[model samples]
Target: MMEPETRESLIARLPDHADTTAWLEFVQLYEPLIYGIGRRHGLQPTDATDLVQEVLLAVAQSIERFKPDQQRGRFRSWLFGVARNHSLNKLRSLRGQPQPAGGSEAFKQLDQVAAPTSLEQEFTTAFRRRAFRWAARRVRQSVQPTTWEAFSRTAVDCQSAGDVAEDLGVEIGSVYLARSRVMSRLKRLVQEVSGDGFEAIEGELR
Candidate 1:
């Protein structure tokens, strides 16, 4: 099984959901999550891609429905549900493969024992955060500290450029300069971490 994603990473990715940046982030962070779901239902790689595409399309269509509800559910389970449905449909459509009996019963039992929202959300949040933290650390190690700090403060911490400049005792122009450098670094890092596969997914959205 793949390691879990952290909350910060997931939240960071969400802010840019419709953008190419967010699409790459999603593939890097959640590809394994989708793959795991597909494998659980006995899907091969091509089938897994089909399942992943369907789930991603569902996410794209219903993204407006995603309100960061710290109250109701985790994106993980809701997304897993989409993948599960798609995977089952794929499995059902396959010819000659014997349908395993009691799988639906198994799902019912699994649902009965489902993890509580708090626990599952906590786990997912932590997992996503760690992933972003890893990417952030990569930038920190490779890029200048000032640049990383500027982006981290403005983008991750939600500080305005003016506020970041004020906090860092720098001019507002420096804040803009730093932001430009950081954005360039992020684009490169995103590509390095996720690759061209994400571009294909984004093309589908377009």
Candidate 2:
């Protein structure tokens, strides 16, 4: 099995155009979250798709200069800022609208008109949901079908343990054990996925 990557080492590989594995990994992880961000920010399907391409292109071009703030978080912090900027850019280019800002002007315009505090709060919530979904898919593949069903029905679907046990034809104690084991595994995988950003959203990741 391929060893899992941490955020720092993963970002280091991004600037290498020859590193297709790294690039594909990066896209698989962040594209959905950024696409969801665009949709939640009122973008249409086409616009959201364009926004994903735009943000991904922007990061690929600029990642050589990407710096993680020690006082802040890591690449995700910079990524979300870029996504928010380009998302606003896309919003302003709809029919009957002026051209969206570009270059350094985009940053200036974002500062001038964006309500970042609220928008970022919303984006962070969106990020958590996306992270959990990613973690669910990853963890499920590594565990038995019955184990995942137990956890999914109880923790995700809000079903009672007794009911899940009856339906799965397992003892109640097995349901309880599966729920505990799967949830614990999911939480660890989520921490790997979220990295530096995990602590900020621990309450919501559940």
Candidate 3:
């Protein structure tokens, strides 16, 4: 989970039009999740890209009006709602349009879709995957090459610690220690990226 201070710092910067750096950071962190949601809902590649821009524009326009209420939800939840609505709008727009008679089954299914639950699940899964990948990248760069190799072999590649130690010319104990350190750092990075609403993802990672 993200610390309260960290969540607030990010929330505070999201609505400021002059905060280009903050906006850029926001885009980098969220664009994949948003874009993935569109694609998962069966949008064409170009249409999904267009939907991404539309959703982001909606966020920029409406962010100033968002007042965080603990009773209501977190900023991330609210952001997801915006993306969901925009995606549904895009899907609805395509419902009655002509398709090449033999369109993909996935594309046809979009016409009858009414609920967002399935797409929301996809978004959650994508978010978790992207968050871990982002954190892993950061952790890899900060750790020693040997430490990262040990962690990767044991934790990521599912290799035996004993074998990894032999390959890395380190003691078995060192491999365990390296894996522990990397896991600890990864947890911190996941929380930093995901905020307090990460219980589900964190549970999966553990």
Candidate 4:
């Protein structure tokens, strides 16, 4: 029962500087996913770190302007736009001819105009992994050590079930059983975080 606030409510509260709870939620949900996207797109570690800060700043400035469209995604689109914009600037800057864009207008324009293309896949992948990590962290602490290791070694580390069983001093059947149990719980947590499209994400979490 490690339920967290939904991203929509998290976004709703992000604008209030006084809401430390909301900001904490934002950091927990976003910082890693945004930073991971930056790295996967070929940014250096330092650049990825800067991308997180830059994206946050951009969001803080533009949060009020966000309008959720029934035909569109809310934060996913805005975040993808903001992250893409900053990431491109960093990449171009590395090449010595960066295009300058700033303020809420830059973000607003991108959010309004950018269709789910190019960076959209990156956004989705990073999002699932974020959900995975977020759920796994919570699940890990709540589960028994052997059970966690069974799931970790098999599902995460990709070790063979027999090997994991031997390493953990359990039967091979127990290994698969542990994995299934952990996976079931993990899926529930991920579904809560993702809110929809769990079918698409189900296979990827493994």
Candidate with top TM-score is 3
Task: Count the clashes in each prediction.
Answer: 9, 0, 1, 0
lDDT of 3 by residue, 63-128 (tens): 888777542566666777888777767877876777644445446656655466666656666677
How big is the RMSD of model 1? Answer: 12.7
Evaluated at residue 194, the lDDT of candidate 1 is 33
Clash-forming residue pairs, model 3: 2-195
lDDT of 3: 0.76
Q: Please list the residue runs of candidate 3 whose C-alpha ends up more than 4 Å from where it truly belongs after superposition.
A: 1-12, 16-22, 68-71, 93-111, 196-199, 202-206
What shift in Å separates residue 1 of candidate 4 from its native position after superposition? Answer: 28
Residue 9 in model 1: lDDT: 42
Residue 43 of model 4, lDDT score: 69
The Cα error of candidate 3 at residue 149, in Å, is 0.9
1 or 4: which has the higher lDDT? 4
Residue 184 of model 4 has an lDDT of 88
Candidate 2 CA-lDDT value: 0.74
Off by over 4 Å in 1: 1-18, 95-137, 140-206
Q: What are the lDDT scores of the predictions, listed in order?
A: 0.60, 0.74, 0.76, 0.72
Q: Rank candidates by TM-score, best first.
A: 3, 2, 4, 1
